[model samples]
Target: MVRWWRRPWIVPFAAIVVIFLAFSIPPYLSFDPARSRVPQPPSLGVAHFWLLVPHVLFGSVALGTAVLQIWPRFRRRHPAAHRRIGRVYVFGGVLPAGLCALTIGAYTPYGPSTRASDVVLALLWLGVTAAGWRAARHCRFGEHRRWMIRSFALTASIITNRIWAAVFVIALSPQLDTTFHGDEGLLSWVASSAAAWLGWTLPLLAAQWWLERDHLRTRRVHSRPSASPTPEPALPHP
Candidate 1:
């Protein structure tokens, strides 16, 4: 069912489940205080909690909205409803994710290596969301499609993370007696993290670019007229 995957909500819902499972893993749940090299401010705990709550809440809402976004009948029949859901998706999903990105240190499980990617991830989330929203507002349908595709790509990182982790552990199982061998485990984590970023986002961006290429070309052509230049006045017939 390739068609099923095209359904907006299906992919997003799947992403949510994948993310939930990834975070539930023991590695993520057990926070290591010593791992955090970044110094905390007085409000670090409060900020962390606040950031975390919204990420979960908005992420769920975004999944729901994605389903609505893909329903052809709903989009055609009730454009206003679609717009409303879109607004919710933006405010709920993208905004908090961006904020959390800014507070990258709060999520680092083990110092710089863990948190190093946070800035890029956060910026990607916000950039996609903002671009999508702006494109929709301007009625740039092609741009809108591209931006939304990119945004969802980033959202799918959660799923990618788990997939990478599973694959890494399986491939290296023979070499390491245990999955938690010190250097190997760290390397595994790094590899999985990198895969998570590339696996989901890059493909989506490529697909969006390919799909919208013609549309963008059409827009550009229409934007410029092919009218022949009027011959300059014959210098008042000299």
Candidate 2:
């Protein structure tokens, strides 16, 4: 059986889909403020609006660079490029976006659950990315890889949240549209809260699982007997 990673096309395909969604959605699709609730805080003031733009732009950059960074081939073939992009992912993308998340999440017009989730997500993203960088500095590549995977998982939350929202809307349209009306009611709050928490958390969990599996596979390979036992020299003498 072909290993999942050895499929050759899956990673690039997924990366393209992720990058496309991350880059394209914001520019092309217009979100209704009330329904989406993302623009509500920014709509209140110019400062908030400015904050929102950098948060989104840098977050997208982080997400894009992060997708590239995870490619083993890229990291192996272009180590310097990987480090440079990693820098951009952290400083340019993750840090600024995290700060933005903190600012907007606290003051969002959305309910308390969303605010709290946003804050948690932001802090985790920042912390994990920073941890990954520190690990790399210390030459702890394994630790760095794990933490970076975690950070990317959180970064991918921006994409996951949208996916969750789309799924919810499509799957539960009648109930969501009628009872909740998209963030205007209790059900809406519940849905938003669930999405907010699950988006990053689920991805993080999956990343950890993948990392652990990879680690175990590596250990198993290394631990395997490297050579066969030699045959007794002279059974004929016996």
Best by TM-score: 2
TM-score of each: 0.63, 0.81
* Residue 161, model 1, lDDT: 53
Check candidate 1 and list the clashing pairs: 9-67
- Best lDDT among the predictions, by candidate number: 2
User: How well does model 1 score by local distance difference test?
Assistant: 0.64
Give lDDT: candidate 2, residue 55. 78
How far is 142's C-alpha from truth in model 1 (Å)?
A: 3.1
Task: Tell me the spans in candidate 1 whose CA falls farther than 4 Å from its real position.
Answer: 1-50, 105-107, 110-114, 177-188, 212-238
Candidate 2 least-lDDT 10 residues: 28-37
1-238 in candidate 2: lDDT tens per residue? 3455785865875767576655654742343233333555544554555556677777778877876787777778899999899999989989998998888878665579988999988898889889999999999998998899899889878778877766764655567657766634566566677778888889999998999899999999999987988977876655
